[model samples]
Target: MKKTFKVVVDCDDVLFDCNGYAVTKLNREKEYAYKKEDITAWGELGCGLDERLIYFRDPVFVRDMPVLPKAREFIQALSRRAEIFIATSVAAECAGERVSSIIRNFPEINPENILIGTRKDMLKADMLLDDCPDHIRSAEVTYPVLFRQPWNLSVSGVISTTTYREFLTLVDMVQKPEPEMDPMSPVVLVGPSGAGKNRVATALEETGRYRRVMGYTTNAGSRAFYRCVSWEQFHYKRNDFVETSSYMGEMYGTCREDVESVFREGRIPLLVMDINGAVNMRLEYGARIIFVSAGKEECIRDILSRGLPLEETIRRISSIDGEMKNETLCDMTVSGTGFRVSSLEKTP
Candidate 1:
């Protein structure tokens, strides 16, 4: 069963492009060239007068301001797995206009979920996503997430994220999983590079019965979904990693928090890792390890076809032999060519 989280998201800069629209409006109407990045503080429009007189009171700004990029898409996606509520602090007079804009832009959100007031802390929820530090600090009971804003950049100690995708990741991390009679154990999918482990992991995730525990990596290509951390950050949080390994001069590690988060969501946590990381997970957490193999010849062919440097290809080929030596430690063995969901059945 999937866990449902009561997510309370703030309006203004979070959902609506308030600052972006304000900057554009000021630039156009007031003959001021104010850029979006220049308005770092709330209500303090670098130009002398507070933003209320210039922007908020304007009917056009209140009713027709554009939604932030990807706001609608992510909110819709999150609503499928969790209950979403919009909590804002717009003025009473303009609240109706803001609500109308929200209804027009996001019809999937129920009108009742649109909360307008200053006292967001009064509402009950599992998590609070807002840009204002005051609002986050005020909501003492709910898990406060400081949504990324130039104004709140200096604030610390709360989970902060810049994008809606990152917000969803944090939501999944916080919600506890539902209890189950036949609870699924955490799974570590191990194999040589290009040996079809990632393919199998993706298939399992698509089944909606598994959640991929995204690992931190230095690889630039995987930075979109994978957590990208600096060398300093990796060292600072080294102890939190359940498993860590180096590949092609880059470091990768699975954080313990991500794994626990997936388990809390009542879905199997799937990890695709190298043999070294696999050994570490098995030793540290007794994680269910599955050895995925495509035979030595096929592994080499796949690696070479991927256009990796010959040296790296050879290194991967050599590592496969060492990985296969640890096959005895795995709970299950799956051939890369014959990968199937049935092969994942729990051993008796």
Candidate 2:
């Protein structure tokens, strides 16, 4: 009978947002419209990889890539059903960063399970899930699971999965899968200021099932924003943050340790982030997103009532429409109609 006694997973396109980020950065920095799908073969990026290689060599650059969408959820579930191992190759310069990223993002995995070298032929596992066809073919595993990518689309005659969720299906089809774990997916409450997302986060935290992750910002508004540290602190421990994004010229981010702490407590980590940050975190961490909105007029009324500088107030109000446009990407939309204007002094 087939069984997933042990499974090896690849890092790049299979887990980390490597190629896509490289493509975006390459396009924006070099002004080239190279689509990721156009990379139909290995080394198709060819000379284009020169810059990406340089960046990948930097530990910060290596660690900053968001986890692939649904990757966290998939791994979390998969690890419970089988012995999971992370096997991939990275530049020697930033290999440690890759290992740290994997362990930090996926605590279910033991550090000993991370394999640095790309010698798939050396690994012993029941199945190998990798985006590279060569690696799949080389693996010593009983089943080589080709994680479909544009570069490997032409690769045939191997077991493959087109989506992250399908990998679990493949496991079930091969073996009688174990009951799945009820993973506590992190939740992000996102909206423009005055949308009462913070209020929702607070409510969730008060329920004891959720822990609100404190964010750090280097703006005068930190005093007005609840559970936010000074941006100076963020600067001091910048590497601790998984990602950082700007909101109205002020920087904000959540540190990895805070989220890990929530996980340790067996509680969901509730977070507040801007639209872009929320979207990235959702994809990177498989976090559920809740878009909180109270309508433009109500949002403006609440912002004005904050009595912040007129310029800052206008900036937040102007960005409301853009933020609202992203509601569709969120898993749930919550009505932030009650601003609780009384608490406006400390929360936005």
Candidate 3:
């Protein structure tokens, strides 16, 4: 079956030529003449004309403005593949004029799909194409695409598009399938400290099928191998990391940028983390978690062979029972003994 995306599109700068209309109105009605390129700031109007007065109070101008270039054609094409909604906000007095303008210009759009409200973030959508920063920041489910405008050029982290054609290209990038040789979803291998999880992760990385994402750690010995940040830095920038946990007197975390970077490069990120970190990740982003175990006896023996104190070995082994119970939480479970990449053939 084909996948259908739920897309919410904005109207002002995205579909309607709001800026052009404002410029024309300002030049014709107001004392100071202004061009489209001259109005660079978001809500700025030349000759001290307020945006609210021009956009909201003027009903005749809102009703007669032209639709944005190529907007009607793009929306018509997009409606065939995705469930499209026109999400816009306007003054209560001129709401009818805005709706009528859309209906008169674009007959393809269903009147039921027209949504007019001040808070677009409350709408449920998979993706949002808008030019407003406040709307993008407040959005809950939609991945924002800042439709190119001089006002929103400084916004960060969200995708941006200069034209409707470029927007279609970005949509294709998000929905296109990866190569047949590439693995599907990113993998997170979770196990106890002494269960050879790192060794298994290394083997999978060596296969060239996965990109190993090193989590942040404060351990002095592991600083060179993994991405290491100070405990204070981690605390100060907590939101930068996807998941974090304290274990064995050191802090470890998975950086959100690392996972997104790997995904942007069209590769699956293979992460090695403890059960606590894995559970936290599952709660946040719903990662594909795999539990790796080598049985209780083998785990204790392996910790002892590393020359650690018996007390530490027992302490690590004591946590095995809790970790084993997490098997029910994972998508798949595999034995760590003699593990190979073929073991993951059945994985999605």
Top candidate on TM-score is: 1
lDDT of 1 by residue, 1-348 (tens): 855568898888899988778777766776776577665566555563354355776666799888898888988988876888888888777888999988898887889999888997797887788999788777854566767676665443344566676566545434522222233767788776667787788777887888888889776655334788887888788889876655555667889999888878878888887544654554445567787877778877887888766766677776675556545546668877777877775433
Q: Sort all candidates by lDDT, best to worst.
A: 2, 1, 3
- Model 2 spans > 4 angstroms off: 1-4, 44-50, 177-348
Residue 118 alpha-carbon offset, candidate 1, angstroms:
0.6
Q: Residues 278-327, candidate 2, lDDT per residue (tens digit)?
A: 54454457666667878788888899998888877777777676567556
Off by over 4 Å in 3: 1-4, 44-52, 179-348
Give each model's whole-structure lDDT: 0.72, 0.72, 0.70
Better TM-score candidate (1, 2): 1
RMSD of each candidate relative to the true structure = 16.1, 15.7, 13.4
Clashing pairs in model 1, backbone N/Cα/C closer than 3 A = 177-264
